[model samples]
Target: MCRSGTAMRLTALTLLALLLTACGAGGGQDAQKGGRKPVFPVQVLEVQGGTVEYAISSTGSVEAFEQVLVTARVRGVIEKVNFREGQEVNPGDILVEIEPQRYRNELEAAQARLDKADASLKDAQAGLKRREDANRQTPGIFSPDEVESWRNRVNSAKADVSQATADVKIAQLNLRDAFATAPMAGIIQSRSVQSGAYVQPGALIATLLRRDPLLLRFTVDEDEARSLKQGQQATFTVTDVDQPLKAVLTHIAASASSRSRMVEVIAEVAPEDRERVRPGTFARIRIVTGSRDNAPAIPQTAVRPTERGFVAFVVENGQARMRLLTLGLRTEDGRVEVREGVKPGEKLVVRGAEALKDGVAVKIDEPVQPQDK
Candidate 1:
């Protein structure tokens, strides 16, 4: 009985030991599976060196190179308005015509008066010659006083002829002024006269504006104005227009405004772009104030705002590392200039930067593509 009892005790002890060992093994497997690290998918881009232009952006209005207010030069009833509203006209193009019948009659009357005066002067001269001949033929028959009087009459008739000639010329000039012509080549902006309307001298007729090689008027701050020079190349983009127009800097104001501390600038658009752009259009100008030939640049999206300053994420040794950067000018195409804390040929994580931090291991799914310079 004692031996059987001892065997039962030994068997029970062996079963308990086996059960404990199995439990320990199961705990070890669970720990091994739970200790696996989580991985995150990330994207990256490369840092590059290229030329970067620093520009000052500004808004401005478009203006014509020339603007003129057309006015009537003579008073008359408007017979016809030759030009329609907003019509393009060349220099010397007839825009308005006043009733010329009255002027013509005046001119004819003046001519008639001139003819009569000329006839009277001829008659007076003939009479003076006759008197002089009589005095010569019959000595003491015709007095010297009578001959002198005839000469005086001829001189008076000559003066009348001269006055009539002057009047005729004045009348002809008035007739020509009855029609108003365009002073310059431009488009009619507004019309103030109509057909059959009575117009007076110096009355408003129309307004004309020249658009070819249009002028863009913009204002810049004092600091920006100081950086600009005449004849510099500039580019302008019209509001809601896709393409940018190239222009040349024409004028820069020497004085600055007291209230705004800004100087005015004028840029001339190319002649070919006149059809696409018009006067009084709003546009934005990008002037290349300065440039660095070899500056490091990165995609603007890669930059992240941090408590300290601007920062970027970089992949180094297959791990994410935070790099603080000093930023420079931003380009029009959404790229930023990097002055410090980055090197050329270094890989930068442009895509997945928002989810990354320092010392995080990452598996690069694809190689980073090189950015364009």
Candidate 2:
């Protein structure tokens, strides 16, 4: 029995040794594999070259190229109103006509007076000639004093004829002015006189606005306004208009507003677009200052606003690198032009960049991305 007991103790010791050996091997493997460092999952985009337009956008309203108040110049009853409130009229188009009878009578009366004065002058000249002929035929038949008196009469008659001629011209002008005409080609904004209404000189007849070269008046930042040229091309989009329009910058204010720090600018609508848009229509304008092709650009979401300016994250060799970017104009398509710092072909962290620290490990989430433009 003592020998069997000793054999059982030896078997138990061998079993314990095998178990310890297995445990030791497993612990060694665990120590060698030491756990992986945490990696931040991020979305990255490849920077690509794109066409970037440097443009400034602003809001404004359309304005008439010229506004004028049409007024009557002669006193008479309004014979006719030839246009509606919004009808377009051309230069020399009659807008209102006064009674022709009264103006015609005045002109005729002035002409009759001129004829009478001319007849008197002719009679005086004939009498003077007779007196001179008698003096020549018979010496001292008529005294020199008599001849001088006749000459004076002729001079006075000549003055009367001259005065009457001026009166006739004045009357003729009044007859012509009886018909009120448009001085320029324009749209009638309002009409104040109607048919059969008695109107005096200088009475309001209508309001006319010139149609050609419609102006787009808008306010822009002073910095942007200062660089604008007189003939710079502009694009316009008006409310309810499906197609965009065009204009040319025509006028810029010499000074900026003190309160708003903005400059007033006027752009002339393109000839083809003038008829499409009207004065007082609200519009948005875009002025392209420059353009760059093959410029490095990235998604706008990749950037973070910083106090100094802006910053973005670039992933290089499995780590995030913070870069200060000199950004250019931001496009409507959600991309920002990188003027400096970042370059094309670099990996830009977009989706999860906000949570990443500089030089931290990042695992790029690869997904099918649409083309960036």
Winning candidate number (lDDT)? 2
Count clashes in each candidate, considering only residues at least 3 apart in sequence or on different chains: 0, 0
RMSD score of candidate 1 (Å): 6.9
Task: Give a tens-digit lDDT track for model 2, residues 20-119.
Answer: 9999999999987987776999887778897899999999999998999999898889998899988999999988889877888999999999999999
Q: Could you tell me the TM-score of candidate 2?
A: 0.82
- The candidate 2 region of ten consecutive residues with least summed lDDT is 364-373
Per the 3 Å backbone cut-off, how many clashing residue pairs does candidate 2 have?
0
Model 2: how far residue 368 lies from native, Å: 8.0
Q: Give the runs in model 2 whose Cα sits over 4 Å from its true position.
A: 1-36, 219-222, 252-264, 306-309, 365-373
lDDT of 1 by residue, 223-316 (tens): 8899888899888999767899988899999999898888999999877777778888999988988899779888888899989899998888
How does each model score on TM-score? 0.72, 0.82
Whole-model alpha-carbon lDDT for candidate 2: 0.90
Candidate 1 clashing pairs? none
Best-fitting candidate, scored by TM-score: 2
Runs with alpha carbons beyond 4 Å of true place in candidate 1: 1-42, 112-169, 239-242, 304-309, 351-373
